[model samples]
Every structure is written in C-alpha cells, then in structure tokens.
Target: MTSPSQEEDDVEEWRVLYQETFGYRRPLFHPEHAVFQFQPDPKFPGHQRNNNRERREENDVDEEEDVEEWNPWKESYEQLSRGVHVMNSFEQFVGAADIQCFDHIDEALKFLDENPEGHHEKLIFLHEGTHNVNHTIRIASDVQIIGASSSEDIAASVILTGRHATILEIQEGARSPYLGWITVKYEVDTEHEAEMALIMEVDAPPPPEPNSSGAVADNDDDDDLEKVNEIESDQTTNCAMVVTGRGVEPIIESCHFQSGNADHHTVVVKDHAAPKIKNSKFIGGSGGGIIITHQAAGYYDTCEFAQNLRSGIRVQFQANPYFYKCAVHHQGEVGVFILDDGLGHFQNCDIFSNAKFGVELTSPNANPTITECEIHHGELGGICVHEEATGQFLKNRVHNNAFLAVWICGGANPILRQNEIFDGKHGGILVHRYGKGLIEDNEIYGNVLAGIFVETGAQPWIRNNHIHSGKQAGVYFYDNGSGILEGNEINGNTLTGVQIRTGANPRILKNRIWNNDNGVLIHEGGQGCLEENTVFDNTTTNVFIQTEATPTVRKNKIFGSRETGILITDGGKGTIEDNEIFDNGQAGVMILSEATPIIQLNRVHGNRSAGIEVSSKGECVVRENRVFRNRFGGIMIASGSNVADSSLNQVYDNLDRVSKAIDRGHCLFSVSGKEFYPMHNFYRCITCNSSDRNGICQSCIKVCHKGHTVMFLRCDRFYCDCGADHLERSCCLRQS
Candidate 1:
C-alpha cells in the first residue's frame, strides 16, 4: 500500500493533469477559471513534512543546509494552483476562501446563507461521503461547490442523496454558481409524493373568477390570497437539479446526476435559463437525462448519457439547445426526442444502441438541424421524422439499425442530404404515409429491402443520390407512391434497379441505371412515365412492363441488356416511343401475351435477335421506327400476333429473315423502307411496263421510280408491286 505522503503526491499530479486538459483563463464566474489553493489539513501533519525539513536544514547551519527556501509557485503543480483542480481525498485542495468543513451539505448551505460574506465568491467543499437531505437546497448567490475526488469515480467521491425532493435548485439571480465533481442522486418515494399531491389539492381553494369589468382589481391582499393554491403543472419538480428563471446561467461540469423518478427528468432547465454543462455523465437514471423546455437553451459538450430508462434528452416547448460531441446510448427509449416546436442544433453526436429510434422528431414545428452525427444500432430505427416535422439532416452516417435507417412518414418533410444510410435490416430510407421530403445527394445502399422505399401516397423529390449495392431494388415505388427520381446512379442491386407496382406512378427521368437484375420493372397495374433515362448493362431486360402495367416508356436510351431491351408481356399495354433500344441479347422490343401497345418513333438496332418481335397473340401499332442492324430480322411477327399498322417504318440492313417475311406474304416494299399503312393510292411502273402483281405505295413511286415513273394504281388494298419478279429493272429502294 502507498503511504499518505505518496497518495498526496499522486492526487497533486492528477489535479495538474486535469487542469492542463480543460483549464482556460476566463472570468471568476466561470468554473474553468476558478482558482484553487492546495492547503494542508491541520489533522494531516504528514503533509507539512517539507516545511519541517526546511527548518531542520536552517538549524543545521552547514554549507549544504543553507539552501534556498522551497517555492510552491515554481513547482509542477502551477497549473492546478491557477485554475480548477481535481482532488483525490477530501482535503487535497481547498479553495482560497476560509477552509470550512461541513459534515452535512445542508449545514454548509445554512452557514453560507447566514454568513453573507460575499457568498458568491465562497467555495463550499463537501467531504467524501453520502449526505442525505430531505428537502431541496436552494442557492441564491454565485457560490462554488466542488466535491473531493475525481469526477470519473462519482460514487467514491462526495455524494448528495435526496428522497422525492429537488436536491439542488439554483434559483433566479444566482449568476454562474459552479457545481462540479459531485454525484447527486434523487430517489422517488412514489407513494408519499402521491399522497402529498392529493393532500395539497384537497386543501387548495378554487381559482378566483374573472371580474365583471374584464380587468383585474389591483388589491395586494387578494393577490396574496390567490397564491394559496398554486401548483406547478409543468412537472419540473423533484429533479436532481432544477436550474430555472432568466439569467440563471450556472456552470455544471464533470458532475453525475441520477433521478429515480421515471416520469420526471434528472436535470430540468426551463424559463429561459441557459447553462453551460461540459464533460458530465448522466448515467443509469430511471427518468430522462435532461429536459430543456419552455425556451430554455443550453450548451452541452462532451457529455455522456447511458442506461437511462427514458429518452436521454428531451427538448420540447420551443426549447433550443446546442449539443456537440455528446455520446447518448443504451437508453430505454429514444436517444433524443424533439417535439412540440423544439429546436436544437446537434453536431458530431454519436447516438446508438437505443431501445427505440436513435433520434425521433415529431410535431409540425419540431425543426432541428442535425449534422455530422453517427446514429446506429437502434432497436427500432436510426432516425424518425414523423408528424409533419421538418428538419435538415446533413452528412450523417446512419447504419445497422433493426429497421430502416431513416423513416420519414406522416406528412413529414425533412431534407436528407449527403448522408450514408446503409446496412440495416430493412430499407435504408423509407418515405411513406403521405410524407413529402427532399432526399438528395445521399448514398443509400447495402440494405435488405430497397435502398429507398416510397409507398402509400408519399411523393418526395429524390435527386442526385447514389442508390446502389443493395439486396433488393435501388428505389421501390409501391401502393400509390409518386415521386420524381432524377439524376441518380442506381446500380449493382440484386433485384431490379427501380421497381414500380400497385398503381405507383413515379416520373423516372435522367437516371443512369445499370448492373441490376432489371433496370426498371413495372408490374401489377403500375403506371408511370419512364423518360430520358439511360438504362443499360442489366442482368435481364432493361425495362420490363407486364401484368396490366401501362407505363409510358418514352425517350429513354435502353441498351446493353442480357435479355431484350424492353419487354411488354402478360396483358401489359403502354406507349413505347422515341426510345433508342439497342445492343441487347434478344429482340429490342418483345411484345407478347395479348398485349396491345403503340411501338412508334423508336430507333431499334444492334440486337442479337429481331429488332421488334410480336408473338403470343399480341397486337401492336408499329409505326415510324428505324429498325436496323439486328442479327435475325428487322421486325418479325409470329403467326398468332398481328401488327395493327406496321406503317411508315424504315426497316433495312437486317439479314437472313427478309426472305422469310416475304414468303409469309409480308410487304416486300417494307424491306426497302417504302411500306406504310394500307393506302388508297398505289403506283405501277408504267415506264418499265411490268404487270401489277404487288403495287407499291406512293413513297416507293417517288423514291424508287423517280422520273421513270408510273401511273397511280388507286388500289385500297395494302399492296406493293416490287415483288412481281418479272420486272426488268431492279428495285431502286433496296440496298444494292
């Protein structure tokens, strides 16, 4: 075991280290600037041995014994001598004032109240013991109370215990009283407190009635009588510390607070009081860690809240606080709860391992800016913005929650930007139930469900996001969800990159979708406009429309698919127009299963199979498209399916199947790019003088015959004379 002298040296070293870490030169009202003096306790005579050694050397009167006097000012403990100090035992470093020892905190408080020798400047040091106080101790001045021992070990230091009462109430006008290095635990005697509240209500009188004149009569006696039945309805009583009133800004640093009352808070700050609390730990409290309400605002830095029965911090009723670098975890409820117009700025906070959501914002006006925080390991979710709450969440890392990392619902409209929301049990972000928000510039990936799941009438503007690398779709719209998905990189998901179903209609515009099972899948009555998207390199078809989905596939660059570029099957009906569909393993456009669609104005090329295929009784109007460079044939129609109007299409340069189409009685003029819908005007080559076995349309007479021309056939049937086989001149429209 170490000697007493050695223990004193260790405590001195600790005090010096603490000051070097947190000391700053400021006003006397600030705890960081409070000066502490290391005075020896008269009971501990071993501390004065250095002084005795100096006297002994002076009496020796030798050359070596005449050394200079020991100077405490030049010692290594100079930092502790200048600012706040941490002490090990009760008598390590007493303050500059008279060293007054008190066995009970109540007695010391009474002494300071009655002495009145500038109590604001006095420092009352509580010894290392648990002092029980039955009532609250109210501080009316700028007194400084610090406990002996390090704040890290609160139970081994000075402890103040109270039963169903406010342990410390720094009342109004108590400017900058510093409370540090102590543990305050308030116990709730629930049965007794309930009975007392009942008795107070029974003895209270009714409130006074309004005057007939609609004005209060200025009577002092009536005002005094009316004060008899005043009970605080805000539930701010029976806390470990209640700092109230305007301008009562105390410094609470390195303190531990615990409240056993589950319905109340450990620290309650209300009525415009703004305190500076730093480096404290609110641990294992049955109640919430702190409540800042009724316009109370404070600055909390580097504080830790863990194992609380309720939320770690509750900010409501227009309270606006600032929290920086705080760790709030292991709470029974949410880590942070902001409601009822509560406003706060949270930065660099780590909120994790909560029973419910890590951070929950509710009510219409609960708007707070949370940035650069890590919120993870929540039992329910990471962050929830509900009940029409609006806030800005920027650059936060939210992951590994039980459900979605962020949930925006119930008409909430929060801006989620530059956040990495991933690795959850469900989706990364969920916007549903009529929620409207701007989710832009966020990296949402590695989720079990969709990266962003929008459903149930929610319409958010999702732009400029990297929604990728998920187990399911990148962006899933379901059950009437409508949103604008623009300028996003949706790729590398195990399922479809974008999935729309069940009447969900999202305007998918200007997105780069690749490397998924399918680029965009619309099924089960889904209806949306897929416009201006570059969808390529998917494992399956680039776009799949089936099961009665009538989505408008327009103006998209759909290519580089393992299967067909666009697949319309299973009774699906849509307008596929103005799209560049190419470079697919199968046909560019595959229509089957009785589906009726308008395939018009598309450039279909570079496919391994036919450019456009109609099979399985599908009926489509194929018009005004450029079908070229396909491996099989340009446009192929199976026996059962039929094209309602295969007209005005430029179908050329397709090899191997043109003769098959001709043998099946298809228009030979279509191969030379001159066929159209059944026209009443046809032309015969009168200059060549051939028999009109198959009459050509007016386009063929103008381009193929030119000046050598022909007489108008005036035939109503769809016919072309280019396949007569007895014509002397070759067909000029065909590529020689």
Candidate 2:
C-alpha cells in the first residue's frame, strides 16, 4: 500500500498523464482536442498531439468530390474543473487571429470575410469571449475556432460567454446598477448550478462479472491491464460544438461541440466539403443536434450525440455519412434521420429515444447498409423506412418501440437478417405498397400485430423468423401480396399464425406453427401450397381454408387445435395427403357442403368429435388412413356426403378402422447415433468465508467493473466485481 504522500504523488502523476495523453487541458471543455495515444506511442505518429493531420489522412482513403465550402462534458471535480486557464503570455483575447467578443454574428462573418485566403495553420481561438453567434457564422474557410486547450495540470476546457442579444439597461450611478444583478441572483444561481451538475458528471466505469468463458478468475489481470493501458476512450464534453463553412476537405477529430447559442443545432454542416469527425461528443441542445447537409459525405467514428431536442444526426441531400461505433440517444425527435438526397451506413450504434423515431429513412431509392445497431425504445418505430428506401438490416437489436419495429411505407424493401425484434406495442415489420424483400432469421416476438405483414403487391419472403406472442397473425399476407413463408417457428399468436388473405398466394413450407388461435387462415383468392409444415396446437383450427382458396396441403402434421384440424368450406378443393391430424376439439378434418378435399394416407385420430366429418362433399379417397381413438365414429359421413373408396384404411378403438390390424405405444424418441462424451472441471476454495459461496464476482457476479461506462449493462445472476474492487477468489488458491 502506498502512503498518503505517495498517493499524492500518484495523483500528480495521473494529472500529468491526463495532461499528456488526453490534453485534459486545464478546464478545457472538449476532451477530444486532447492528443490520444491510440497504441504503441503517445506521440508516435506526430508531435502536435491533435489528431487533425492523421484524421485527414484517413479521410483520404475514399476520394470525395466537393461542391461547396465547409465551415467547421466536463465532469465536475470543482478542483479539477475542465476549463483551462487563460493563456497569459498570449494576449488574453485580442489578437487579430483570436477573438474575445462576438457581439453579433456579423463580427464572426467579418473575420471570415477577412480570412478569405483561408485560415490554414491559424486558429481563431475563442476564450473569455462574450461572443453571441446567435445565427450562423462561417469559419476560417479552413480555420479551426477550437475551444480545446493543450494542458494537463487541470481538466482544461474552453468557455466562451453567450450573452447574445442581452440588452444593457443598467443605471450605473442611479442607485440601480447593481440592483439588476441582485434581482437575478437566484436565476443566475440556478443556471450556474445546472452547469455545475453537468460538469460534475464523472465518467464512471462498468462492473465486471463472469469471464467470456463463463468461468471465474482469481486475479484481476484484465482490470489491471485496462488501467495500465487506459486512454481517453470517452469523448463526451460540456458544450455544443459546430463547425461549418468553406474548405476543400476540412477534417475534425476528437471535438466536444456543445450548443449554447439557443439555436437548434449542436454541430452542423449546411453545405460543405467532406468531413472526417471521429471520437467526439455533441450534447444538450434544443435543435437538431448534429446536422450534416449540403451534399458532402461525412464520416463519424466513436462519437456520442446525446440529450438533444431534435434529431441526433440529420443527413440530407445526397450526402453519405458512415458512422462506426457511434451512439445517438435521448433526443426530442428522431435519433438519426436519413432525409432526401442522403443515406447513412451505421455500424454498431446504440440508438434509444426521448421522443420520435430511432432511425428515420425518408429518401426514396436509397438503401443504406445498417449493421449491428442496438435500436430500441423509440417513440415511434425502431426504424421507419419510407418512400422507396431500401437497405439491409443485419445483426441488429430492434425492440421496445411504440410503433412497428420496422415500418416500411411507399414501396421500401429492406432485407432484414439476424435481428431480434421483440417487445413492441405495434406490429413488427409492415411492408406496404410493392415493397419486395425477405424477413429471415429474426427473433420477432411480443408484438401487437403480425410479425411480418405485406400489403398491396408486396412480395416478401418471410423465413426462419421465430415469431410468437403477437395479438394478430405472425405472418400476414394481404391484398395482392405474394411470397414464400417458409422455415419459421411461429407460435403463440392470438389470431391466425399465418394468414393469407385477399388474393395473396404464399407458399407456406416447413414452418412450425403452434399455440395460435388459428394456425393458417386462408381467405378469398389466397390459393397456395402448404407443404411439409408442422402446424399444430392452434385454438381454432390447424387451417381455415375459406371460399375459392384450394391450397395443396401435403405432408403436414395438422392437429391439436380446439376445433377441427382442417376446416374447408364454400367450394374449397384442397388436396391433403400424408398429414398426421389428431387430438382436435371437433373432427380431425371438417368438410362443409361445398368442400371436397382429397385426403389420403393421413393419420386422423383422437379428435373429441369425429375423425373425418363430411356433410356434402367429403368425397375424399379415405384409403390407408390410421383412424382411431376418436370419442365418436371415425367417419361421420352424414347427409349428401360422398365418402367413397374407404378401403385399406386401418381403423381401431372407436370402431372406425375398416382395414388391417393396429398397435399402440407411447414414449418415442429420436437418436443421433453418434458417439460423444462429457467433460469435467474442478476447483478448490482458498479463503473460505463463513458462508459457502463463490468468493469473487467472477465466480459469483456482484461487483463493479471497468471501462468509461458508455453504457449501463446489468450484470448476470452472478454479482459484479472489477476495476477498483476486485475479489480474491480465496486468499489461498495458487497455481504458483
């Protein structure tokens, strides 16, 4: 253990490290400007510490075309406030290159107008300035009005006063000069207190639990390694930072851009060159937080855009912005808006909500690649695709939205794969108006409507989706829609599990349909093939083949419903073959007056009512069927029913078997017939406590963890322990 004095020295060394590594410049508001140690060396590539040059180089990987010019959270520790001291040696705020006052937006415009040659290699630093850029201010052509300092003695941040539009109505010598200050003292205090709270937010770390292998470790090698190799991975900061205006290709990295001008945007680009902004934060503004517009592609990596009023990041007008490991959360409106003329490719972004859509795509005919995003809790849908927008959504967690998980309108086709869409109040994916796509391998559950609904000529292939617990059908094809619904596990939907209505002809194959109100409901003109599907345990019937829809149902297990297994009526002529239909509330197969389904080689048994009840047209070849154990007669062929050719069908128990001998047995299991063995793991306790339990959170799961705590992850059943609080599995167990 280090002594108090030694601890103090350690603290000093840490302060130095902060200064050297992240440029925690004394009281600097934005942490990004601090030079980062990516790997290997602190200043391995260059000496300036700022990543502007390196970022520019990275941006050059994709050659971009430029049409116009572009302009481009401190936690409190009151003692370690993130604002840097005013540079005394340099003029406090009065260099021709530096600014101490704004007074109006024109002053900034004037500065830019004078720097028409471009402020390259010159910084228009704003320190202790009462600059009120209430409106837009163009930058140094390629200039940086950076409020980021370079000092480590303190949490050096940049602060510029925004008293824009405040009228001076004070009486200096009339006994009322200081009265105004006193009158507004409490309000001023409240503002200061809020600022203090914002500053005091410390970047806490996450807790630790079981290892990746789900095993417990005795030592905290991971935690120690993390600390020893800790860099400023967190990029959140105090203010809204916006850099806009002209330049060929302006580059921005590691910036904290806060909005205080009472305008709507935090950091924005109206019309400018391509920008490469990585490792930044934009927080707490009323307007659209980060707006990237004007036809230039933007690249943002590892940035956090949180606590804003409008959309987190608005990409508009032919702009292509690619985001990697970015977070957009807690906004008033949309999380990320891909408006007309622009598309966004988002990778590994966490987008929750404060108000509206988590991700909104408005442009028609632009399908962006969205990979591995955790999108949840939107006021509207997790993702709203409108007007011919097309994209591939892969490896995403889309759940808990107020509206549909994915709402596609006006002919948008989004190929969805490997997504978990669950627990939403509305439908899962609604494809309307000629949208053509596939919904495959998605775990879609707990929704109100059909998991996948296609309407108005939409031909979507719905496959491999585990859809359950919805209020309506799991997959509904309606109104001229045609597709293939195959290989899906659809169960527990309140209504029909797969509803094909309104002329929709969907080939339903190899689907596991169970525990639904109706397994498969077919309405008018919905004629398709139901092949090799395991449809069972529905409340009403396994299949409700309605008028004029004669689907060829072959080789299916249709049973265990409250009513008849297969209900056919109104001239429905379905071909049913080799189906195992049993244990239904009514008959195994119910045929109405006009129904004439051809059934052959089916195991129809154990129905409470009848095995094959026909009124008018059950003229099926009842041959080779195993009909037995029904409460009533197996063949209840009543008036006008033509049940002919009932030969070779083995009937028993309920006196329904007409042909051969039958045997009964229970408890059937399938075997893999492959050789396998079990493995064993052993362990011993060292420092045994009074109670017998796992010693460490690694073993138990009750302790704090590590990292900048960018997200809150609840630990598993085991407690959490990591970071400063690691456990000693037992004080005795030793491999040494």
User: Given candidate 2, what's the lDDT at residue 195?
Assistant: 59
lDDT (C-alpha, whole model) for all candidates: 0.79, 0.60
Q: In model 1, what are the clashing residue pairs, if there are any?
A: 694-720, 694-721, 695-720, 695-721, 696-721
Highest-TM-score candidate: 1
Candidate 1 per-residue C-alpha lDDT over 1-736 given as tens digits, one digit per residue, 9 for 90 to 100: 3455664665555444533332321111222434333333222235344664666666874434434433232232333332222233345434443334455666666666677654233556554567788889898777777665434464346788889578999879787887876788899887987886786789875556669978765544442122434644347778899998888888887788999988788989888988888888888888899989989998999999999999999999899999999999999999999999999999999999999999999999999999999999999999999999998999999999999899999999999999999999988989999998999999998999999999999999999999999999999999999989999999999999999999999999999999999999999999999899999999998999999999998999999998889999998988999999999977899988988889999999998777888876888899999999886678877655779768679999876344554445444555433322222345677787755555665555665677975776443334455533335655554433
Candidate 1: deviation at residue 484, Å?
0.9
What is the per-residue lDDT of model 2 for residues 1-736, given as tens digits with 9 covering 90 to 100?
Answer: 3343553454455445444322333422322332222222233113321343455466663224431211011121222232222232343332222223343434543645565565322233333223333322333333334432443211124433232221111111111100000000000124654654464454434445779999865655542122322432111111233333334344555545555433345555544545666766766665666766655556788988888887888887666678999999998888988877676689999999748888887767565778899999888789887787777899999988888888877767778999989878888888778776778999998888778887787777888889998888898888877778889999999898988877777788999999999999886867778999999888888899877776788889887887779988777776778888888877788777577677778888887666776664445556677888875456656444576666667777874321111112100000000110000111112332212222122211211211211222221111122211234431211111
> How well does each candidate superpose onto the true structure, as a TM-score?
0.76, 0.58
CA shift of 489, model 1, Å: 0.7
Residue 73 error for model 1, in Å? Answer: 7.7
What 10-residue stretch in candidate 1 is worst by lDDT? 22-31
